[model samples]
Target: MALAFGLAWVLFSIWMSLPWLTDLGNLAHPLIALFVLTFIAYVPGFMNAFLLISLVLRPSSRRETPAQWPSITILIAAYQEEKLIGETLRSIAALEYPGKLEILVLDDGSRDGTAARTRDCQALFSALPNMELKLVREEHNRGKARVLNHGLELASHELIITIDADTRLEKGCITSLVEHLVASPPETVAIAGAVLVANHDESWITRVQQWDYFHGIAAVKRMQGMYYGTLVAQGAFSIYRKQAVIDAGGWPDTVGEDIVLTWSLLRQGLIVRHAEDAIAWTHAPETFTGLAKQRKRWARGMIEALAIHKPLLSMRKMRTMFIWWNLLFVSIDLTFTFAFLPGLVLAFLGIFWLAGPITLLVLPLAALWNLVIYRIQTRMLKRMGVKMEKSLSGFLLYAFIYPLLMQPVSVWGYFAELFGGKKQWN
Candidate 1:
């Protein structure tokens, strides 16, 4: 077939054009090395652009009619969330599209008054008709995977939404997410909620993360949601079609249960969509230590999630490709994290000057690319009608500083998870 020959030719051409690794990494010209590295690295990004364009053109499942409201259960796993759970319960009681809803809160051995607060909320929402609240408690601490596995079994509704205790739902969030699931084909198994950092103004660390979530995750989810195989349907605010969860073997006991669940659903050839309109506000870590711990847990969990799923065997091309993209970059990301900038700085100190004017273009060109990425994210957020913070400082950090910061943290996470260190969640 002409198609097979064309593919072979393209592969051969690319292989022939690639420079030897040792020569490419330590070139005579510092700038040329940087440029060459950048070019080869972004080859994947360019290939992924086709996938992004496909999703952006048709962000939804293309259904326009009203979907019938279904009976649903919202599940929340709580620890020391006493400060936030009351408001979370109130937000659920305040749902505008209250058809038939049951709320289940699992108090996973919190030493604090998290259990008592839920009881108070139970009394508060007692009069809210068609809304049921079931509170469960564990005498001691167990991991999130265990808590959620139990919650999924306890839930009696056809549709289930998993929420974090600290998340506050916007008025239309529940309605929008459920409707997106309802409108989707029966094979469309889960929906991811757009998570915005509510505590962005609480501290400098939170402020930095605010833009990262808004500008980074918001756009990434929209693109990934295209074929309904977004990597992670976050536990913070995710809706699922129940039978699909049962079919996918419930939530697994991995550091990253949410992502593993998403992968499992995809492996089974079910869809996991992103409902950008279904908004949820959750608190971010307000300190560097806090943020690092959170990221480390997430990173370690992600590695574990990837290991457990080992998705290449799946017959679905799109799902396999998505997993492959994430898996493909472990060594590359670590290389850039440790070597790239440090090498450039050391080269300058060692009097390794640029060979020509061409090498001087890397920094400015990279800065421009960052700016473009931020602007695209801003436009996406505006399209979704999410509010943007007016901090020029945050915007600048988002464009330049955040990428460097994330790399080291991810590296630390990989090591920590591998070595069995750092395992506490607040």
Candidate 2:
């Protein structure tokens, strides 16, 4: 980690010393130039360089399977998910884990027949050996965090796994998570599973998100996990030490419950991991409005976590670097929205105010970084017996058009949380 950081700083220093960049600083107002060059070239450039170096230099470790599989309780928080709850339970039943397993469907007062569907599936899955399926119904709509806390209170095993109602685990998902978390040091308390878009074929929006998931999201998680503390052990599909979660005070009541909970664990000096092979398929939002809402909430969640876990910055741990690095994301997003996008439009209109020669210098590095991430992710998927489809359109959109929409929406989310916007759990 030190080597990676050192190399990144050296390269950044070299870039800053370039004559044309210095000339730009002299030509423009200091504040405007600093904002343009820092966010556009400096911060993101350093981050990408660090991630690339760390990834290329990451050491490989042999994965050892556990001799005995520990019992696990699966928690699914459902609200108006009648159409998907049955399939989600069926997917859990199909898992290859041999250990005693318990499944809890926490129905958070769904207006639909979610509970009925769960109960019907419960009867069908009852014949499975060494498995118990139960439904816990709430009379009124409690949010996801509270529902998961209730499930935590009733969880029957030491290991707890949380999956969203729209999530479907691969056959080997549970085994992979168990193997990774158990092989980790005793302090390792949670492992986030790799989540991919299941409905990429539904629309162009989902298709672009598929690339985001398969490439960008996976790369970020792998980079963070390399240092032994993944920031967000996503509730979409993750495994946690039940006792560790209890020690962390269960999930917090926030839009980004998963983010806050994971940060809380980190704040307590516990290690969280990511299992790249533990794959889960989740439904992505098919419409633009849905995607914006989802990304906004995610952005808001990051802000909330950072605000709540401010003391984590003072922690003397290797993973604490990631906590500090997260502070740059909102600034990067804001600059991209308020500065870069408009500059892009101006450049196309034959004005080179913000999007000129210096800005274009970042593209080659960005392309190389994406290429590296894509190859690594594809190799991972290939090993899992998953085939990549040839989707030129999706890749192009994800590369060029996705950011134009994503950054602005994320800025909205940051401001929304700052101003106490209405919090709704989709």
Task: Report the number of the highest-lDDT candidate.
Answer: 2
Worst 10 residues of 2 by lDDT: 13-22
- Give candidate 2 regions above 4 Å deviation: 1-28, 388-390
Candidate 1 residue pairs in clash (backbone atoms < 3 Å): none
- Candidate 2, 1-426: lDDT as tens digits: 645664665476447545645555777775677776678777776777777777777666335687888999999999999988888888888888889899999999999999888888876677888789999999999899999999999999999999999998898889889988878888899999999998889999999999999888998899889889899999999999999999999999999999999999988888999998899999999999999999999999999999998999889887887887788888888889887888889989987666666666567666877888888888888898866574678889999999889999999999999999999786
In model 1, where is the ten-residue run with the lowest total lDDT? 352-361
lDDT of every predicted structure (CA atoms): 0.72, 0.86
The per-prediction CA RMSD against the true structure, in angstroms, equals 4.9, 1.9
lDDT of 1 by residue, 157-243 (tens): 988999999998887788878777777777888899989898888877788888777656776676677656688999999998888
Clashes of 2: 0
Candidate 1 residue runs with Cα over 4 Å from true position: 1-40, 43-67, 313-316, 347-388, 422-425
